[model samples]
Target: MSQGDAQIDFYPATQAPIFRENWPRMRSHAIVPRSKEGWIDPVISEWSLEGAAWEDFHPHAEYNYVLEGELHISVDGEEVVLQVGDSATVPAGKLGRYWAPKFARMLTVYGPNPDGEESTDFKYEEL
Candidate 1:
């Protein structure tokens, strides 16, 4: 997919790649490829973590929607616990930590990506 392609993309919720240690041992799969569409830059992915935690700073705003289990996010000096069907947005540049006590599945969206393909670089970091 590329800019001006203007084609619909369908990625099944259950369609996830092999679990990889992308975030401090947490697993994630990139659902949307890196691309530029006009002035918009977006990243989409499915993530799951169990008994683990990870933290990072995003240069772009991030929206996380819980799909199953629960997710606990600590940002801006507060702990935001999101259960199934819950959603939350972390402001750009905020240090956010995500913790899954037992297990959690989520749909994540990061947008207005200021760094293009590098916007979601955290997913590939060795950390």
Candidate 2:
């Protein structure tokens, strides 16, 4: 089947598309097409923060791929800096935090939950 006609589909970002001229901004778009079953849901998010920090997120599971820039991600107490072309997985029920030193963009997948009832909420501190 032709590229467009095949049952399998393709996304430009999944195959390494060139970043837009105005890259590094807070933006997101759904990756996997939505469905009733909701087996897998992926979102592409870009973060451009000079000194932005996030509150603790207790999620069931989070899969992330760094597309550009650098990010400080902390799970529990240990922290790591993820750069472009890097990937990380945060397990279920873990406390995680994220910050952007300069700018960053990441593709995140949240799903494959067996119970299908996972959710997340942020707890921010007063600045």
Best by lDDT: 1
lDDT of each: 0.74, 0.59
lDDT of 1: 0.74
Candidate 1 lDDT, tens digit per residue, 5-91? 878778765656536534444667788754553226567888877777767787778899999998989887899999999999998
**If scored against the real structure, what TM-score would every candidate get?**
0.73, 0.63
Candidate 2: give the clashing pairs.
Answer: 60-92
Off by over 4 Å in 1: 1-6, 12-25, 35-41, 117-127
How many collisions per candidate? Answer: 0, 1
Across 1-127, the per-residue lDDT of candidate 2 in tens digits comes to 6777768656545333332334333344556533434454443433333345554453447777887788778887888888988888778788777777666677777645545553556543211
Cα error, residue 106 of model 1, in Å, equals: 0.3
